[model samples]
Target: MSDSGRRMRTVLHADMDAFFVSVELRRRPELAGQPVVVGGTGNRGVVAAASYEARRFGVHSALPSTVARRRCPHAVFLPGDHTLYSEVSRQVREIFERYTPLVEPLSLDEAFLDVTGARRLFGDGRAIAAQIRAAIADELDLGCSVGVAPNKFLAKLASVEAKPRAHRDRIDPGEGVTVIQPGSEQEFLDPLPVQRLWGVGPATLDKLQRLGVVTVADLRRLDLSVLSTSLGANQARHLAALAVGADDRDVEPDREAKSIGHEETYAQDKHSPAEIRRELIRLIDAVTQRMRKQGVGARTWTLKVRFAGFVTITRSVTTQNTVDESQEIIDLLTPVLAGIDPSPGVRLLGVSGSNLGTPVAQLTFDDVADERPDWHAATDALDEIRDKFGSDAIGRGSSIVGGRIRTIKRGGQQWGPDQPPSREISHEDDATR
Candidate 1:
């Protein structure tokens, strides 16, 4: 295609392979070639990311660690280090932003960049991607894969195709930066499974499978009207377009996060109310810390639980005010937990804050003297201390007394004063243990 006809529109999807586990390996290279699963390392813990070695045994993220161990007994289980991962992710983003302002981060390890306009500023799309991938590897010592295509869908697919493999001794130089030009995206995507499509989750895949639509080609063969009738107009249209490798979505530079949340799946099902409360407290602390760091406050709290059979439910409540207090979260969550029928046992629990607002500043007054300490100054000091000495450097005395609570790092690792503990919930009307 002519340059003007093609418009030289190049979209890139950059993703770090097994991001959490990769960060750990970068810090301790000895862990290389071993199966590493990063997540909660507790009785009630879940896997966040399974290294390629572990995946060979069918281990994957969000799977209960107990099950993961059964599947890959030799896997090295590491508690996630959120702080370290966050720092590394920041470094990666810095590299992307340096190349182009049109960088959109999907998560800590994945993002998209529109490099069309950047060619004039930097070089061609492939050259910019090479620089970005190189920067991440050199500066952060972390390997990342990049995909380049004419649009977002193809770019994302190209990245997935570029996902790193364990056998590569040296990172491939620019091999990750695969380019799918216009008119070739459809052929490139046809053989892939429908599940590879961005919006095709387990439920949707199951539904599509019922109609014998197992691959992208099959889905593309169906009439658009039939797809619209089955999957609704908007989703059907989007899926149809995606199947043909026609994606009009731009590389969004300013993607806003709709919500922020943290969750944990226990190695063992928790049934104790008190234990559940303790877990909630820990989650509150972690979520609030993230909110503070992001300079955002939330007005709603959502509690998510998954039962033994994988039945999941969510309950949310809007607060009169936005407060990050752990006790407030406890008060709000206790009733919700009480209402659930605790039959099979609780396998997972999560807390999410939404309806975000500008972070509010705290106020404090000195009653004895007609002077008050600057709230901002006090907050800054506390933040500094915590940053330098770690989260445990300062915390509520109540939290200290609650020895069972643990800190969960962004990489899905759990650390605390003691081994992480699981909680139980009882549905019995009268029970004395």
Candidate 2:
């Protein structure tokens, strides 16, 4: 296959470079060359994104902020501005649409675009990738790395290979864009670690290690029957196919989310019931707000509680009616939270909504007599306030009283390692889900 046109299916995976930190640098040019971390600076805060300079000190996303500070004491930590990130992501998506409509967003920072249909108009895969990257750089002042390949699996892996790497003494500026031509897929994948294959999680890695399969070549050498016996037949077939670079998955555009949820790991465990309830209320509000934005409601709500020692438990309730209101969710979960034992001190709290569909109103007899304010109208008003002024422009009275309900405040500054986070930090364990 030549680079002139798409004789084979072409996919391009574009990932923003150190996305959150890069956006911050675009706004604050003074922080360009410095080690910067974008996340909550509190003891319990987790790193969302770290600049290449900061990563050299062994700091990266999802690592505890406390550990990140201990490693990179001089690093500048800033609370992230998610609203700004979302807006920039929308702009990036618009640019992708200009090239092709088959754009699948994996996150705010990355997406996969199937451009086979666009080759005639846009030259070819590599040319289209280059144009997209250039447009993003020129329009958004953001840096991105893209990978062009025959399939989504290889395209995503190539994007990772194209991203810059941080070393102890220096950073390696990788190829901004990489192309994996037809008939070169095996050559491109053979020497990589077996762990690089998608869906090879910790358990699968351990299984593969036991089989002495450390690289793609080793996985390829294993007989189908052996693999089928070791890892269940279905997964065995999946890995076997991937080992040979035979991914046929299409790039799905605007994929509907399976679930919506938010979680927070606290600096200190909450022993008081009132504190736990308040946090629960806050989480429900956040989750429902997102659901409303998506025009979906949840029939099931799951409450995740992590104890001090990392022992986690979840309680779920399915309602007859799909709910998009925070107060309704709060009422359903309050008893569930009350039933859980907090004597061990809860270290983390999470709420997730699932079994989603369009919300249907059921006029209950109790609801007719209950003269409560319209929660939907109230939330709409709150959303409008947030859209205009900012997320912190308004809040629930209970959430505002003690300031304990707010996590890390968005866009706040961190002067030093030990400073407390000024506001609530909302961490989504699985945004795509």
Estimate the TM-score of every prediction: 0.77, 0.88
Worst 10 residues of 1 by lDDT: 424-433
Mind giving the per-residue lDDT tens digits that candidate 1 earns over 1-433?
A: 4545443588899988789998999777998988898876664567878888887778888887788889888999987777787888888888888877888888788999988878898887778888887888888777788898888778888987777554333333336677787778777988999999879998888778877899999999988888777788898888887898776676778877778888876666777665566666667767877777888878899999888888999999987666554545666877887787655788788899998887554443542365743444555675688799887777543344345213466546332111343542332322211
How large is the C-alpha RMSD of every model relative to the true structure? 6.3, 5.5
Best-performing candidate as measured by TM-score: 2
lDDT accuracy of residue 212 in candidate 1: 87
Give the poorly placed runs of model 2, Cα more than 4 Å off.
1-7, 369-395, 402-433
| Tens digits of lDDT, candidate 2, 279-388 | 78778878887788788999999999999898999999999989898878988998999999888999888899999999876776777789756777887898888779
> Which pairs in model 2 have colliding backbones?
259-433, 406-424, 407-423, 407-424, 407-425, 408-423, 408-424, 408-425, 409-423
The number of clashing residue pairs in each candidate reads: 15, 9
Model 1 error, position 322 (Å): 4.0
